[model samples]
Target: MTAPIALHGSNISYFTGKLENYFRVKGLDYTLHAMKFPGDGKRIERELGVYQMPVLQLADGRWMTDSTKIIQWFETEQPTPALIPANPAVAFICYLLEDYADEWLWRPAMHYRWYYDEGAHFAGRHLADEHLGSLPVPGALKRAFMRHRQRSGYTRGDGITADAVAGVEAIFLRLLEQLETIFRSRPFLLGERPTLADIGFSGPFFRHFALDPVPLEVIRQRAPAVLEWVARLWNTRASDCTGSEPDSVPTDLGPLLEAIGNEYLPYLNANVAAVAAGKKRFDADIGGVGYRGARYSRYRVWCLAELRRQFEVLPEAARADVQALLQQHGCWEPLWQEKLLPLLPGQDEGLPFRASTKMVGANETV
Candidate 1:
């Protein structure tokens, strides 16, 4: 018998919650280990060359990093109870949503945690203690520093400032409303079964919305449907397991799709252009608010390239469907552009094109 896959991460981590939830839903043979920061530093750094969590150790002993890359491996290897949509256009939409949720929502997610004092104190202290409770430093100091780091990173690096806060809050409010409305109709984001899109959302939804104190209060009060959906995903069994209908998108999910087109895609397009222009700093007009000073992210830049590549490879009918869906929701242009977005080929070793199959030649099981 093969060994169980080893997942190293913490519940406090957003991406970690995502991978953990997915594993439970699939009943995959895996064991979870808390990522020890100070104690396990050497091994963690050696495997990833950076302190990244939710590392997956394949049964054969090969290791992998990056949540999306790991999910892509599962999509290719374990076809049963598929998280990815088989329809090319639907699959493309899933990938796009995954990318946006993974890369774009980092700012809002970080902001919500740090903006309100209640959440700020809870998450800040909780995370620092969970990861570094064993460290010699006082817990209060670590919390204070982490709180500052989380807040400033968004304020300084992701361009979240006084001017942009309103727009970001607008996104949060609209998202809560839209998701609540969808949940009123269906259990999962797409339909019955949880798709990669649902998992994408779970990164923020589970960690921030469901867990954080302030947002949790907001979710419980303002969006009970949202809370209900969260509870559903947490359970091993859910009421809506009918799965998505073939070649279809859920009508209830239109608002989210629209938001993606209107808000997130604009920033992505601007970032894509910025990366191509070889600029050190990038600027964007998000929701009519001007945001500047965030440096280009090689990982996000690669996300755009990866998405366009997926779109480019779709079949004619599938391409037509994707175009129509995106166009209807005001998201066609950025992705529909003729020129491929630039990718960081040499500079980026963070996320690979795919998992390594060379070492396990003639066999692909994880």
Candidate 2:
């Protein structure tokens, strides 16, 4: 008998939605332990050496955080209704798309959640305060929280303004347009069955954009097709991928992953760089105001860091595939020469800030 899997998470978290989808797709038996808004969730995460929701406690007592890591574990352990396409090319593409969702989409989503609406803004703050019991009182606590929030505040980029919001909105619209074009032909992003890419993108799509009242309305008005797709994906009842009983790999996925790498990923990478550069400029000029007021530099940095770490873990041949994709997308130069290289110029000891293609495995040091 296998030990039961336990999930510690919140209902409203987009990342949690990602994990839920994984459980459904893999047909894994698991139980969710919903934590109190900020308190219980934060406590468990801190003890486990992570700072986010959707943490997985395996039967063997091994704890995992981050949706990407959890998904990879599922792929290795379950290997059915394959989340990662069998073809190296397609699997790599799925990884890239997943990265985009986890990184790029987070900023705009956070911005809308905390900044656009007053009700949500206050509600989030109160929740945080309550979660941080004995930390401080209301007034001073709010100030401290704001300072901490500014460090990871999601924004269009380093500095966000009303104009920045508009710019990010345009990017979202463009992405929606592309997705609508593709989804019009196929039900899922990859094809008949949902792949890892679909699960990754859906997490944020459902949480911040679809469920949140303010952003939900925005998505409905601007991108009805995307909203529809979200509904279809979430409402799916199938236990596993077609033709796979317990665990079966999809056979025909090369074309889909190649298309993602060749056509979609470049666009996604450019968008991420633009947001990061723009936000950084915004913050430098405006000075640190508050989390609500400052640009979301730290969040962007964290996203990039995760990507770099993943890249390091790929096999050598696999790394080449990613590099080829990055080069074709025009990302190789800007990501290394312009943005990343300058960050850790003199530091050669730790992971340099610049992005590079390296193969890392499950046992490889990060």
Candidate 3:
């Protein structure tokens, strides 16, 4: 037996909830500790080289950051009850879904949490109590600061303008309808047991979509099955699941893949262009929404590069199958749109221990 790892982050944080779900499913022992500001900010930055939530302090005194990398590291260390499916093509599909869920769904998730008055008030109050209690500021003042910082960094400051708000929200609605169909037919995204795909999605659903007031109401009304899935995943343990690996991907997942192809990949391509051109902010028309001066992410540029790297390492047969699936869903062309990605030297090389950048670099203090 090992000592429980110290996980530090706000209880309501998006990435924190994601790491929690992954740890629960894997049956990994961990203790969740609040990331009190001022002190924790400096400590985490020193330990991990970036100020991000859900920093995992291992039993051996080593610290880890970034939920995706942490989960991958555990998957390597504890290979039984694999979170990634055994089928080669299915495994690649899991990576695709995870990436889509991580980077693309994040937009709508933040929009819902900060753009609406109900959601902002609810999350603001919770976060203020959870992380800002040590600031010695008035409770109301802390809540107001939380709201302003989030709205400035994530929603309005990131890209969701009045004209784009409706379109940005429609992304969530479409995802819910698609996921609602799949969850109604299966226990998890792939089959009877959870996979990386499900864990990836837990980033958004567990913290934002299922918990935020506005999106929670939307889920309760239209996608109750998805709501059930949220709780079901948290209660599930990977060691207890006896389901067989899927031989083929479900057809119902086509809608989600199509969305990744049509919307997310294109957005990545646009971000790539922006990074290559040395722009901090750029305008893009994605999913028919004109986003003016939206923040450009160097981290997201690495995400695109990482996805292609994942594809390149696939077995020959698996690569062929993945190519066909991605092509079928209109993902292939845009995925490889940039023949040469403009990446900095050794970007994100020291992941899980040290980070070169945050998801959104503009607002680090928040």
Which predicted model would earn the best lDDT?
Answer: 3
lDDT digits (tens) for residues 94-209 of candidate 2: 67678767655665566666665442554366545544444545755664564346323444323456656665554456567677666766667767677788888887787677
Question: What TM-score, to 2 decimals, does candidate 2 have?
Answer: 0.67
205-256 per-residue lDDT for model 3 (tens digits): 9988998989999999999999999999999998898888787899889999
Q: Provide the overall lDDT of each model, using Cα atoms, as 2-decimal numbers.
A: 0.72, 0.56, 0.88
Better of 2 and 3 by TM-score: 3
Off by over 4 Å in 1: 237-246, 337-340, 346-366
Stretch of 10 with least lDDT, candidate 1: 357-366
TM-score, cand. 1 vs. native: 0.88
Residue 102 shift from truth in candidate 3, angstroms: 1.0
For 1-366, candidate 1 gives per-residue lDDT tens digits of 136878887777778888877776665767877777676656865666555667777888777767887788776777667788787877888888887787767667777788888888988888787777888898789999878877666554567777887877677788899888888887777776778888888888888768877778878888999888777887853223665544688767678778777777777777767767887577788767678776565456566667877889999999898888888888787665536566634544544322221111000111
**What would the TM-scores of all predictions be?**
0.88, 0.67, 0.97
Ranking by TM-score: 3, 1, 2
Between 1 and 2, whose lDDT is larger? 1
CA shift of 229, model 3, Å: 0.7
